[model samples]
Target chain A: MLTKRIIPCLDIKDGRTVKGVNFVNIRDAGDPVELGSAYAQQGADELVFLDISATNEERKTFASLVRDIAKHINIPFTVGGGISAVADVAPLLEAGADKVSVNSAAVRNPGLIDELSKAFGAQCIVLAIDARRVDDQWTVHTHGGKKATEKKLFEWAKEGQDRGAGEILFTSMDHDGTKSGFAIDPLARLNAILSIPVIASGGAGNKEHFIGAFKEGKADAALAASIFHFGEVKIPELKSFLKQQAIHIR
Target chain B: MKLAIIKYNAGNIQSVSFALERLGVDFHITDNAEEIKTADKVIFPGVGEASTTMKYLRDRKLDLVIRDLKQPVLGICLGMQLMCTFSEENATECLGIFDESVKLFKPTAQDQKVPHMGWNQLRLKDSWLDPSLEGEFIYFVHSYYVPVNPNTAASTDYIVPFSAAMKRDNFHAVQFHPEKSAEAGERVLKSFLK
Candidate 1:
């Protein structure tokens, strides 16, 4: 059986791992390579690094960081942020990233997903959606949630899948940094609508939240950052907890 | 021992190189027919459309070269599919190292997904690579699979039981990406190296 994946996300700026609350007030976590290696050792099914730095030089730094991480970790890892064109993907894959996630770029031009999935195969393209509840309906937000688009969250997700995105990383802006738990209703809706895997992100305060993500939210994978980065929750401990709940963790 | 990974336009060969790197195995990633022929072992790894990739290989005449390799050779995912007799993917003819046809996976139920992405157990038949991998979970990601046949070294069931691994003569292929499968996967690759 395909197990439910527990992923630790690293938000990197200038090649260093960082975490923030609700996309602001960022703080340093550690070196991305060291942290990623530790997560793989502790049984993180996968790792995701978002290059929050959207500059050319930092992209180079991120590429080298991916190379460094791949040297130490055997499991699959994904890199995202600032990836726009088809040319942006090859260097990262060459540096050993198994998959690449596109958010703002994909939203701006939905065709990029088609182009990417065509060029690199469907398995390598992930569509990361950052959303928040607006007037009782989820709205797609980009630019780290500072900007909101007219696209409805559910419709946009479906379109992304149609464009050949293999997976969806849906992060709830309302639940993010709050630790109040995932926005289960929206997550379950998204999971039900898409045949591909859905990874629930944000608002994982305790072990129970993860259980809720898999059980109530119907997420195929759960991604958390602050809790795992700050050592508030260890991956092994979380896996055992999920395993006890019969979640079939990896 | 020198190992050569047959390079093409396909993506994700880096994972294979990294897997070999972890095992302390040195290798060269080259498409040169002579380089491939001289290697102690050759790994054909790819992630691309079969028809287009086959055209690329045939253009370079690497297709015939791969068919004649005497040393142990491993084909992964798309590489495995291309080594078969033919592929339903774009209706392409392949290297025919193993006389099996690749077909698209048909999910029987509403919830059963195609692509078979994620970890599943391996049921091994006897092979020099390792029978101990039977019942072990390995990672797989593909929309097409090779049906079970005489050359099948191991099998895995998704929507149907299919060839998880294949062996005939000195050519071997696995449908799964052993590099992405953690410890059990590394063990399988280590056995291949041995």
Candidate 2:
């Protein structure tokens, strides 16, 4: 059986991890590779390193960091953030990232999705949609959810899939950071309409929330940051709990 | 062992090189037919479209070299698919190392997704792969699969039972990415290295 994946997302800035990580055994919390290896050791199904760096030099450093991570961590990982053009992706993939997620740039230029999918097989291109409910409609947001776009969630997601995105990483801005729960309705709808896998992101506070994402949202995978980093919810314990709940966790 | 990673116009070759480096094995990535043919072991790693990659392999005449190699040759992902007789992906013919046809995955259930991405357990049926890896999860990412055949060494279930790993004489192939499958994956690679 294909198991439901549990992913730990780490934010990278200037070649180092940002946002406080509370892993006790970590020698350097800023080291994304070490932290990523630690997470992989704890049975993280996969890892996502979102490079939040702003400058070109920092992006170079991030690419080098990706090479180091690939050399050390055995698990598959995705690299995202600041990936605007097709050229920006090769460096990351060449550095050994399994997948590369494009957000704001993809929204601005929908053709970018097609080009990316054509260049690198659809399996490596992840379309990340950040959206929030507005006027009873899910409106897509860009630039890390600060800027709003006219595209609606479902239509844009369908378009992304048609444009050859292998998977959709949908992050509900409304429920994000609230620690309340996942945006079940939207996630369920995305799965219902699209044939590709949908990874539910944001609003993962506890283990039950993960269960909800899998059971209710019907998410192929669930991703969370602070909860895993702060040791509030360990992956092994979470997987065991999900298994007890009859969820096919790996 | 003099290991040579067969390099073609495919993606994710770096990941395999890194995996070998982690194992502390010296290897060279090359398209040289003589180098690949003379190596003790050859790793054919790929992540790309089938027809195009097959064309690239044919253009360089690496196809003939690969077909003639007598050493242990392991194929990964598209490399595995190309080892088969044919592929439903763009209707391209393959190397015919394995007498099987690669077909696209058709979802029978609503939950079954294409690209069959993420970790899934393997059912080992041969000694080429470590028996300890039985029921252990490995990473896979592909829309096309080679169905179970006599060459199947390991099997996995998604929409249907498919060949997770296939072995025929000297050529071995796996649909999963052992380079990215963590420790269990490392063990599989170690088994191949042995």
- In model 2, what are the clashing residue pairs, if there are any? none
Question: Model 2 segments beyond 4 Å from truth?
Answer: none
What lDDT score is found at residue A62 in candidate 2? 90
lDDT tens digits, residues B20-56, model 2? 8988999999999889989999999989999999999
TM-score of each: 0.94, 0.99
**Best-fitting candidate, scored by lDDT:** 2
Scored by TM-score, the top model is 2
Flag regions of model 1 displaced more than 4 Å. A20-29
Q: What Cα-based lDDT does every candidate model obtain?
A: 0.86, 0.93
Clashing pairs in 1: none
With candidate 1 superimposed using the best TM-score fit, by how many Å does residue A154's alpha carbon deviate from the native?
1.2
The TM-score of candidate 2 is 0.99
Worst lDDT window (10 residues) for model 1 chain B? Answer: B107-116
- Please state the Cα-based DockQ of model 1 relative to the true two-chain complex: 0.55
**Model 2 chain A worst lDDT window (10 residues):** A53-62
